[model samples]
Target chain A: MELPQKYSEQELVWLLKQRNEQAYSYLYDHYSGALFSIILSIVKEEELATDVLQEVFIKIWRQISLYDTTKGRLYTWMLNVARNTSIDAIRSKGVKNSRQNQELTENVYEQAGSAEMKTDAIGLRKLVHTLKDEWKILIELSYFEGYTQDEMAKMLNIPLGTVKTRLRSGLAALSKIIKP
Target chain B: MNTQEYIESGIIETYVLGMTDAIESAELEQYCREYPDIKLAVTAFEATLEQHALLNPINPPSTIKVQLFESLKDEFVHPVFMSAPTKQSAKVFDIKPFLKYIAAASIILLVISGAMNLYLYTKLSNSSAQYQAILVEKTSLQANNQLIQAKALDLFNSMQMMTDPNMLKVSMPGMPGKEKNYATIFWDTKSKDVYILPNKLPQPTLGKQYQLWAMVDGKAVDAGMIGDCAGLCKMKNIPSATMFAVTLEKKGGSSIPTITEMYLAGKVS
Candidate 1:
């Protein structure tokens, strides 16, 4: 059967629940790039992020039935799936290494090359770069790195309330900075 | 509750970021549905995050999509078999063994009557047949009672949803050419659940089904397909809408609504 090119969020959710193959392809084609970038930010390797993207899609396909629209938008839900899956991959990689290697794994970003990476949206990258260091760190750690608020507070040597406040303002600022 | 303070407190941002724990998330979502300001704040953050992702999309190798679809091919093989059974049928005790016992008893009676007399044998067999018929009737009545109970429970739930103060009832009258068709949507404001009751709407022709649309900000959002639901067919949950409509589409529904085939339309007040 011929499939429509674009689907509204609700229709996409419905068809995905039905396990429609066309819808699945539509979902991948439409959202994979965005999802890949999120995974790349967390995992920081195109090859690894590609693998994680596959896992994310598989998880989404298997668990589409459990998705509750009331919880959030479909992309938000999928983003969580992608983020969590990417985070899990990182944590497991750390666990697999020796204590020294684990520390090295954490610092891998400093040594990793950015030449091969292609984050096509130069404006978005520029906007994020323009944010204050603290705000950028807060967004990256929480959003990309999937760190919890309490963990961030301890790590940042700030009170839990401070972390909440900073995160709020940071996100609000980020939202405004990137607004088209 | 001061919605402005709550919004400014940053919980909505955290909630949109998927950082809020279950309880906090649930509370924020409740507030979102109840307070327009909170909802708008949540929506704004969600939109911002979506835009953020869209702006920084990194195309994965094209082969990944091909591999992904290949991995998912098994799911396509038996979608129907793997689907969860929708109807929970009431289990009735099997009556076949009872019929066998009755048949055996009649044969025994026949053997005994042949030795005693034929007249007594006919009377015994006739009474056994009557008893068997009564047994069948009783079981059928029990099954009918269970079915009625199930139906009653469904009616009760439908009524509760319909009578809920948070539920908005939108009566969609037929469009110009199909004026006789009508459907009512019972939408729960808090839960965002949508149920469409096709009252006078005609049955869709083969290979076609009626699809529900929630018009939000002048765009048609797919609510769900109206399949062969009897009393109150539950559609997808609609977060927000200004109007609702129904259009005939190919079976399984279309991604974009076929506006020309719209049969019913109604504004939400």
Candidate 2:
């Protein structure tokens, strides 16, 4: 399908604040893909991810007024909201129980299976594989899983400094693969 | 301070990943304002991370959009009725009674003139209330019209800026972890005028403000202090500038920009 006409970030934000329905529709059409991917990366379950995506858009509509452009871009703010909402969904008892019953060792991306792997996903998996296990795990937990540095440190039984260094190195390595 | 060592310290990367604690993030923003190199490193790292996130876009099922719009239908419709003038005036002016009073007054003008006057007074008060409702609606409509006109003008100006060949567009992406943060600078070199396109920057702390700097000959010249983070803002014109940057400073701006507090900058090409 053809994409909606592109709007500059400022214009899109202004239109949103004005409660323009077209802008909202455009926002959903353009951003739902990336946002759904982010939510799925964190929540793992397709059903739960769909629910979280719905909640995220509702929150965006209700709270678009609270979005201060000075603070960040619309997408960045929306991404944070999506990540937080997805994390909250995962924390619920039903999701947690299902997650535990599944393979505890499989990360969300791997559990998604190879059928879903398009060229982009293939590239991402390849880039991720190029990193050391320590770096890869850190990237997965922090970036995809939405774990904070302190949380990653505690979860991995490592010092905060190691988490920081490893995250930097991991990103630096991934940067090379993606950019090169 | 050794900026290279600081960049190598991996703090910029950590910040870009959104892993930094609040205090650490605030400190990094301060350093970015004071040092250009640190700010540049942060911007580069942020760009890389943003790229990484963009790689795995997956379209959600099409059914979701239909479901979402259906759910929001009430929200859009309900607000219109709520804000609309309640149709209470419809019951206020019962035309039968009004016509009866007028007909009765035409005959026996002397006998019932006093009673008629009393009845007319009551009718006048009722109509006044109806008139008040109409007046309020008129004012609101006027205000809405004005708002629409203003928005149209803003869009027109933005379009003009985009199409004008004399205007040089500079993309000033946010520093470090603020990769999503950005502002555009439109320089009409022929006119020597600079305009900042509305952008997202973190709101400065109380008693602090963002100042624009035009870098010429390695010296930072104060362009102006930005007042609003929204809408297009005109900044002080310079004969020429090789690069442009923004810095957080004391409320009114400082004589020289705090290099470490620099939020964004771009070289003019």
Candidate 3:
């Protein structure tokens, strides 16, 4: 069953404090698949991805008591958990280096947004596909690859200022395309 | 700033793209917190980014989700794990096993328990068999003892025929030189029978019976003969005896006792 709408994020946190199994299961249903997909994308190995997913949940459970509503929303906190956990998986194993991962991200640049995915994600991928090439590359570097502007500048052999401007310019163009 | 004024700066979009620095994010967060429109703008932008990832989402194999869920469910207490806030939280949880591990452990426990049960059953049977063997041997020994008891009872009944109702017991005391040596004879004058018990007498010198005589007024009359009853030292009923004596003599009975050979004598009193 779906989470009841009257239960605000505050009420949900209260329910979680009670250590309600229903709340935990409800939370997982909404986020586990998505978080697992993100982790598997970064970790690649199914076994390690599974491990990281469990670690993320354990962390959430242990630190839920510390969650402050004033800091930001629950979604932002959860995304941080997911991103940090995936990165931690690589570091803890000491096997996967980001430099190595960058080399293997696949020539996905050309066909990245063109996959005929069967999920509801296909529509969103189509929106990203609708963007122009020059803009899409910078977006991918900043978002998917999690590169800093200075790193992007270094990789492309451009001035840091130029990388920042193009990235800002490109995102502006893409936001327009997304809206109307 | 108007939409174009804000859009023209390209900073809001950068803030939206999350490529902004700490100062920039703080500035944006402040502006978003102050202005409802700016917060909406940020939410909309972040939502769009999330959507893009969703659109191109790499749907991992269905098996991967199942694997991830199951693995998390089963937690072995490896040192790598951090405990929950309480010890009680660490327990009271089910250990859902990985599929590969579940298969292996099931096979192992089945084999071990099966072998143990079989060994126990065999031991029980062997112990029962040994107990039954001992019981059979006990039954046979009891039967043999019963047979021996029946034979002893038969012998006792046959000896009843030798009893004399009117018999008188005569004690024969040893002579002066041989005290502690003695014999007894029972005389049934009505039946003219006598019974001798020469158990207290020492071994005779030759193959001889201790002769008995009836002496009336110092006159000797032949009564009967006595012979050793081997080591059993027992004798049965005979004809008669007025007085009895044991003496060393020849193999057969004599009508009178040799005075030098008389070992014991007694009067009918």
Highest DockQ among the candidates is held by which one? 1
Cα lDDT of model 3 by residue, A1-180, tens digit: 123423457766766664554566566665666666667655557788777777887777668888776655565566567666776675556444435666665643333323322223222233544567666566655654456777777666779888777777777776766662
User: Which of the predicted structures, 2 or 3, would earn the higher lDDT when compared with the native?
Assistant: 2
Tens digits of per-residue lDDT, candidate 1, A51-86, equal: 999999999999999999876788888988988998
Candidate 2, residue B175: the lDDT equals: 75
Kindly report which residue stretches of model 3 are placed more than 4 angstroms away from their true locations once superposed.
A1-7, A40-48, A65-68, A87-130, A173-180, B1-4, B7-18, B47-269
Q: Which stretches of candidate 1 lie over 4 Å from their true place?
A: A98-127, B79-269
Candidate 2 residue lDDT tens string, B118-181: 7987897799788888978887897797688667856656666666777889888877766777
TM-score comparison, 1 vs 3, better candidate: 1
**What tens-digit string does per-residue lDDT give for candidate 3 at B1-269?**
56445545567767644468798778877877777776766666666655544444444455644554465453322222322323222124344556988868977876896798689769967876786777677767767765665454344322332343455777888899889888776665565555666758776655765665566556656555666442212333444335666666677766667878787788887
Fnat for candidate 2 (0 to 1):
0.42
Q: Write the per-residue lDDT of candidate 1 for residues B1-269, one digit (tens) a residue.
A: 88888877767767776777788888887887889898888877777778778767889999998898888888964422223324335344433435878979877876785676567567777877787788677777877875885676466457656767777899999999898889999988888999998899887799999999999998999999887654789999899999999999999998899889999999998
In Å, residue B261's CA in model 1 sits off its true spot by 29
- Between prediction 2 and prediction 3, the one with superior TM-score is 2
Candidate 1 vs candidate 2: the TM-score winner is 1
Question: Per-prediction TM-score of chain B?
Answer: 0.54, 0.54, 0.37
